[model samples]
Target: MSAIRPAAVVVLAAGEGTRMKSATPKVLHEICGRSLVGHVLAAAGELEPENLVVVVGHAREQVTAHLAEAAPGVRTAVQAEQNGTGHAVRMALEELGGVVEGTVVVVCGDTPLLTGETLARLAAAHGGDGNAVTVLTAEVPDATGYGRIVRDDATGAVTGIVEHKDATDAQRAIREINSGVFAFDGRLLADALGKVRTDNSQGEEYLTDVLGILREAGHRVGACVAADHREIAGINNRVQLAEARRILNDRLLTAAMLAGVTVVDPATTFVDVTVSFEQDAVVHPGTQLLGDTHLAEGAEVGPNSRLKDTRVGAGARVDNTVADGADIGPRASVGPYAYLRPGARLGVKSKVGTFVEIKNTSVGEGTKVPHLSYVGDATIGEYTNIGAASVFVNYDGEHKHHTTVGSHCKTGADNMFVAPVTVGDGAYTAAGSVITRDVPSGSLAVARGQQRNIEGWVARKRPGSAAAKAAEAASRESDGEG
Candidate 1:
């Protein structure tokens, strides 16, 4: 492909997308971490055009808000009325100040699978052939809803395109359909759009009419057939959206596998476009790696795990866990059923076991927080063992506080640490204790009350019940022994 930059790239997103049945604009619907229009803009941005414009309508506020965050520098044009594609491009041209001399590439916002490489090829072909207009076309098994490309029989030149609604039975039989994507000579496009009339069956101006108008003026018109028809697929509803997502995910996973990442079950392992993996990283079945998650070499995430905006260091393993905005250090292990919330950090060789939840806490190297624990807003030092069913009671009504457990500390099972407290290095806390005060180094802290047994309580409290009957039987046995 030649290094030809487009003068302007106009994205047609102004359609109401009635078929989508969505309150959100069709172009704002997402697949694989990117909205439909966002994907199109990304591909168009690859051309490095002097001007990039998105024509927005029908929920423009939502789409505009998205663009402000996602692509702040790109310009937008408004199509106030629900006109046709021709009117949408006309608005984009007006936004560009109507002075474009180089190649102008136009693309539909709904086509997420269209690649930058293909767009570049279209632009190159348009420029190389000196064509007044060049269309991106595809030959499909079904042309039910697409525009049919009509070509001259003898010269093989494209004559015009007919929308499926207006196409005759003979023309509808043509397998080669217009993709609604084009690369046009900028000045000629502007001149031809003016001649387009709202005389079609839908009473709207059709961009396809421009091709016919330009051809009538003796200008060369060409069509570039896409290699894969799937690349031209559009998303209008939930079903198509899901299908597109599957295709895109397959592509992403295949590329990752080719790059040396091990995906145990590609079909069941879902990954976002923003996720990255180092060589030797393993993702097991039913795992979803989303957002900016990164897995270092030798990291293993398993059978039912979802990690979002998290980083897993080398040699770490996360099993059946759900983590968000967390960091797992090298050689660390997390869960068969753990939840790691934002700001949770596990150090080297650390372990967070089954049914544990960690939030806004840091577990030091060699530390272990075993099953049935909730550690929140706390810091635990190296070589420490946090026993099962322990709770870091860091919140009290209005404010949140922090707890600190020092190096080599041993916290017993069912222990609770009250916030603003500290356990010094080598200290031990007794089982079932609630430590409200700090413990000095090398000391044993016990905050639990002495155990006492209440005799005959069950008999008095529950007469004629199973527990009371059992107590009476035991009392009779005691009397016999006496």
Candidate 2:
């Protein structure tokens, strides 16, 4: 297959997005586990641009660091002050240090919903029509915040883009608005940008003015109206951020559902692009699968569970749990309120019952920690039974120690293993025991005090107690009967 020819891409990420009311750079805000600029970068990368330059200003350091990590090898240009889109584009052209040849695509950083397919279409339309500039446009019910597209009524040629504040009544009523995305003939972008002026009402160099310059220079200006208006939506505040999140999530979930994964409630299930579900896997409502989580076939998670960087093998079931950096083997059962921390590993058919918390531990196949247990820094052999309310005392203020239980062992309720300790195969520990020493194979360990009988102890403790009153009443009744 032939490689796609590279085009120049200039992304404007220099605005502070002041209305977003955040300390962080607006383009750094995230939705669907990806920052807004990250989404734009992903789209731009699809084009295989020859020269990729991101214009950075407000919180430039943060944005630069993020770009270094998320999208490496892409160059950055500094827009020293908050001017306007035209000025930002001019900075990008200067950073090229040479001519921007074939084509140039200009995009806003805060449009996370923009897809590579739409960008490809825009570029194709511009190059095909031999247009000097192609303005990506959208038709919406309300065009209040967008620039109005002014067209020559009879010839149907794009005359100019009038900002809302500068538009007259007739122009303001135009439903078709400029989406702030544009494709320009590379040779014309630099010349047209230079001719753009800041004489408008806002006294800012509007890139919209570039379209007028190209038109007056006897160049053909075109428009590519996007099919989905939301594709060109720009987020300026939290409300718009939330709307974009909903749209992006719906798209992700729809794709997952079509791929044979079963989602019980699409509305409440939040899955990152990094999450994968094999066929027959079920994800219930209120589940968040984040940070590279994977569920094998037939694995079920949810009813309010949250997992990050965890793996659930086939046929495993996790309910109402919170797990991070853990692994559950096939057919294993976890939760109803369990918490599994980093390094927790459960073998096949094993059970981590209700109200249990485990960390840095491995429970062998067929083992069961029934309920109300805290196990950390431990290892258990197969077929072991850990009774309810049992604990592995792994910490002694300064450092943590290990506990090991061998195969076929039965640990009684309310037992505490004071580490570092070991229990051999087939060993049994009595209820309410606290074991500090190791138990040999096939042995029984009892470490609690024995019970004692003390008759009349309650009578001695309380002279006028209920027993004394009952005894006197019974004697009086017997005498009366006699």
Candidate 3:
């Protein structure tokens, strides 16, 4: 944690991103489970500012509603009109009670790649150099549309900023462009913003004008070049959004890898910011770990799995599965095409095999629900075996009911346990049985109808059919043997 704390942070999110062509506000567009503005607020919040206010204009209600949830307790200033950056900051200062002291940081909300460390460094640079205003500058290869940072030849101090539309030929050649991010002396900024005029070609009050106003007032104006240009990159349209998303995801995956999590194929794996992995956790290709999911140490998940808000315990293995709001215990095995829905849980050493669907159910320690089973609203005790093609019939047209299989039970293949039924400990169910009533401990329940045969039925019903012909041939062979 850096010791530098800003007096306030004004985030400008008032621009109407027409290029994005989205019904949703540009700042509200999400990347890795967080809105673009939310990412900015998180970085700005790290500065521990005394006052943090966001200026919202385009899609104000939606952005404000999102802010309420994303950063509760952080204030917002509404810019009723889509004006320039100068007006946005003025609105934020007004919402901050019209007076602020100490260093104030101003940033754009669409730059989700900006980090807390960079903001802290900027604030520290402003305070340490005793400058009235310090603009964040980047040297980009193409500076066609950005404001050019003008520096004095004698002392290399920032003299002013010239917007691209208003720059001279020589100024346009300058590669050092303004990032539109700044750290300023609070009192100086509040006074300088008052003198800013809408005299530019765009007929809007450019925030860059404040730099010249402060410079002419005999206050020192400086510039801090960002270490990386991408950190200050802004998102305007879908293309830039995708680029930023890729960069941020790469950063997250790299950090996770450095922290002892093994991402087998980082290019194909996607992880949310809220997801966490313990040391030694391994994630396979084509896996998406999303929304507060956690992987314990030694857990291995999928070549093609997507888990949301789920927990996989140590030593558990999940392959080719989709699980949401589920829990798998240590040493448990799930999937080769399983679906674990909300409230599904597998105890230690339990197994859920291919084509199994578990919902609102629990499999106890050492139990197995293997292949082609749909188990819902049920619980199976320790050491029990739920055979292939089994169904826990939970829905009854009006309500969903529960089923229970006690410890050490052996359930046979093709079994249907109707809801509101139970099988006691050590009990067994015969194959092809439909169990409806409770079975006593150590007993065998055979609920299917008795077998019966009707001889020559196929021959009488269809004399020339394939079944009848085969029956006639078998009868001739039997007669010859007799």
Candidate 4:
């Protein structure tokens, strides 16, 4: 058995996709948290290509910068003119120092859904058949703007490719269209690129012309029908860009669903590629789980929530909550409308309830910081009840201080714990109180002034009152009856 030769990948991203109607470069458009060009580079990286080159022309600076970040060490070439695919690939070939020996897999950067499996298969077919050029073709429902494949009826050898605008009536009716992706023998491809002519209607050098040139020169040319045509779909305009995003999201959602996660509404949910969900994890509508997020088993995530860089423990429920960089323990329940900021940690079975915001704080197990509170730069012990509308007044205009509430404490509604303050274990605070100093353990803390009531002074003070007028009228009416 002979060893399969090495391969290099050439990504064509030189053209400015003006049809996309956006200021941003087309290939830089994002899908599933990655740019279209980045996805293509990722696919090529999977095959471990010996040399990877990207041809950039329009918005070269932007494209080059993106490729540098996304795929470091990959080569780049510039196509000065608005030439066709053949010219772009040729420019990429020129950037290489020596002749490429094995194969050159040409890919379009606008195709985000193109996978490494298909590229490997294309390269394999080219090597196994000992062919000079192998074109990836698909049968589309409408071949209107695509190039149609022309094959010999007897041998099924690809004879040539005819563009839709230039094809005859019979050729235009053919269903199989060229995908603009190919695997070519390195030397034969280089030789054929030189012979491709700019004599077509567009007067641009079409890469499809290379196949016919190789065939006429007595080198074999073959075609491989792609398993899924959607993988080869290209993004040209805004509509197609949106379609690509939809397809990529669908792919991610499908994978997540198949991995034992229950997505209540796939249409409304947006899960990033880096997010992971364990079995029995349930995701509700309008939820977006982004960067570095992980949901443990039996975790229920909301009717409307956004979580990023957060680890949710098993059997936890987050409803209508928004959190980032937070760690939530098992059986924790958060929000009908809560916002948890970075460094927020909730212990097991703890509750961060409606209209609450917790930042850089930690709540102990079984504690309930339920509705309408702001807890920041503080720590609460287990089994404590943080009354509704209570606040940890950590900021005092000069500096921020800490509030510590010991275990088994019960705070009153609307209480303000002015910081540098501590509420001892088993302590209780009166409603509407503001505590500025520490309270002793097992004590009842009350800071409000005592209330007093004054009565029977209204008649003299307000003789013109409606009550006085009504009483006087009643007395006159009784006297007249007597």
lDDT of 2 by residue, 267-297 (tens): 9988776787888899999999888799999
Worst 10 residues of 4 by lDDT: 1-10
- What ranges in model 3 sit over 4 Å off? 474-482
lDDT of 3 at 445: 95
Best by lDDT: 1
Error of 4 at 301 (Å): 1.3
Each candidate structure's TM-score, on Cα atoms with residue i matched to residue i, is 0.95, 0.91, 0.95, 0.86
- Candidate 2 residue runs with Cα over 4 Å from true position: 1-4, 462-482
Note the residue pairs that clash in candidate 2: none
Candidate with the larger lDDT of 3 and 4 = 3
Report, for every candidate in turn, its global Cα lDDT versus the true structure: 0.94, 0.91, 0.92, 0.90
lDDT of 3 by residue, 1-482 (tens): 45878999999998889999989899999998789999999999889998889999988988999999889998899899867899888898899878688888999999999999888888888888999999999999899888999999999999899999899999999999999899989888889989999978988878889999988989999888899889999999999999998898889999999999999999999888889999999999999999989999999999999999999999999999999999999999999999999999999999999999999998999999989999999988999999899999999999999999999999999999999998999999999999999989999999999999998899999999998988899999989953
In the predicted model 1, the residue pairs found to clash are none
Error of 4 at 264 (Å): 2.5
| Residue 110 error, candidate 1, Å | 0.8
Per-model RMSD to reference: 2.1, 3.3, 1.8, 4.8
TM-score (C-alpha, index-matched) for candidate 4: 0.86
In what order do the candidates fall by lDDT, top score first? Answer: 1, 3, 2, 4
